[model samples]
Target: MSTGRLIAAYIFGSVGRGQADALSDLDILAVVENNLGKVAELDVIKLVPLQFASLKPSISWYGAARVAEMFQNGELFAWHLSRETVSLFDPNKFLQTLGTPAPYKECLADVRSFRAILSGIPPQVQQSAVNAAYEAGLVYVCLRNIAMAASWELCEAPDFSRYSVFNLSGLRKCPISVEEFDAAMHCRMASQRGLQPPHTATVSYILGIYSRLDPWLDELEELLLRKENGRQYAQNAV
Candidate 1:
């Protein structure tokens, strides 16, 4: 794909927000002027410098029109773009014109996304250290999303750090010890960095934490569902 077709590009997530740690990966969003269809033809690796290749880029592609629509609809992507992203390339300044989305809408979207992930989790993760670590990280992300949504609803800035989510005041107290959560976060960080796989102890600790957290996850889901239903009812009554 020609670079001329690119409308804008941004770095988001931890790195963009200046909260990245040693293990953070790069998240890049490329908005193209034309609808390139479902299959992305652009090779991101070819665009970055050779030295930065080791930092494994997680690239997301979208059409310019789709991004504009997302901004108009107050969608999660638009929220991130407006509030959390650092624009790297934008000759036309396309992203500068967009406004930050409503925090409540973003919170609801986070709840919905978390619920979808929770619904898809397998009853038993495969018996491999890597698999176990990956599953544990997935659960951690789901819990973090719940905490983030709650924080946003309260008009507080949502922090994506593991420490913030694990210590969220309104969240049910984590049954795992602080050491255990630390181990899980380390395991996740290592996995993301493509380092050595998690050890058996790390895997067991994370799984145990997940097992204990199941009920809390259920409660969180129920609360979100009730809030959504209430919103619908209020809309209808109006």
Candidate 2:
């Protein structure tokens, strides 16, 4: 009840879409007056464990002023929360006071940035399966955002789903397979929730699949970046 420095919090992602399963973890954006240095977060979460056990929440922190800044900057994540979020805690209506965010306009650039991060995965996975969970987690997040950003850029319905990369289609078939996608997703969730890492067999499987991951990043990159019939990419759709 006495949540110090916490301004507001909201639920988003799968739970936001009304499409969560036992496997899905709750995603929370906790808008705080300021970030509690990392060590204090462990102490604060000890405040409410049982209540959040079933949902297995993953909380991302943002300073209240930072949230306002993100809105002003027209960040995709700001728009994402605006569209698909359910307020969990807000005594002062901090988010409501912020009002609508500026339009999202930098999807292609974001996609390119995430793709660059993914480019390192193949070499890392090739070196050792010990980091398979980390490598798979990278692929999962990077590819998911790449798809989401591309959707926003193309004037398509934005999908913030874990499987959005696979969900996106029409221009080219998804390079990620269902099984591969699921494996990577589990790795990410496990890392996010500090749960047990993936099984040895899963690590091996992910490693095998990753050797091919880089080759297709180039493929999907082109598809996402292509201009359709000389049309300009969408801007300010939100």
Candidate 3:
């Protein structure tokens, strides 16, 4: 099996199909037998969970076998093991191969910056856009840190539906449009076997605090994307 496909099978086999979320990253660890000289072929595949028809999965392969070798030796593992990973699947053997831990000061800074942003928004605006997404980000970061401390291979995405188990499901459902709401509710009922009114007002109360106390949330999103992409670019440069 191809490297990427092999990893997907493991994720689906271990975590069950359809468990990954839109924001989840796929962390694949492949071992090449006998230090194969100048090996070339490697692949990765990602699929959006639902309703992301036009988005294509991001794929990357190292042109240099040296890069692949270093990666397998854990040179690039720290980035994945950072405070951003919410692991979906990581094998036992691979877990034993963990490299040295990276200091998460940078990660903590980003998290603190995001929380700081939450404090600068207006009260009314906080009641809407700012609250829900900010709280989601906080939930995501906390989960990411927890996953890292556990030594699991961290995929940089959180499974929101999985995240729902933390009482954030209702919070995730808060941002839906009428159509989105109906669909999400349908899925919720199908999965849970009953209709339950979302904790809209409750989520709002928590998110409201985050929103009003923060800066515009969009700025934080852009900052995180830039930082994450920058980290990937740095890793690729290694």
Candidate achieving the largest TM-score: 2
lDDT of 2 by residue, 161-232 (tens): 766766666455565588777777788878877887667324566556655656665666676557432345
Candidate 3, residue 227: CA error in Å? 25
Q: Which candidate comes out best when scored by lDDT?
A: 2
Estimate the TM-score of every prediction: 0.72, 0.77, 0.29
Candidate 3 runs further than 4 Å off: 1-43, 46-102, 120-203, 206-238
- Candidates' C-alpha lDDT: 0.65, 0.72, 0.35
Q: Write the per-residue lDDT of candidate 3 for residues 53-172, one digit (tens) a residue.
A: 333333232233433344455432334432233333344333334444433334434444544443443343456653443343343343333223222212233322333222322112
Please give the clash total of every predicted structure, in order.
0, 0, 10
Candidate 2 Cα lDDT to native: 0.72
Residue-wise C-alpha lDDT for candidate 1, range 36-149, written one tens digit per residue: 543343444455545445665888888888887888876655766777777667788888775555444656667767857754544446345537767666766676666666
Query: What's the TM for model 3?
Result: 0.29
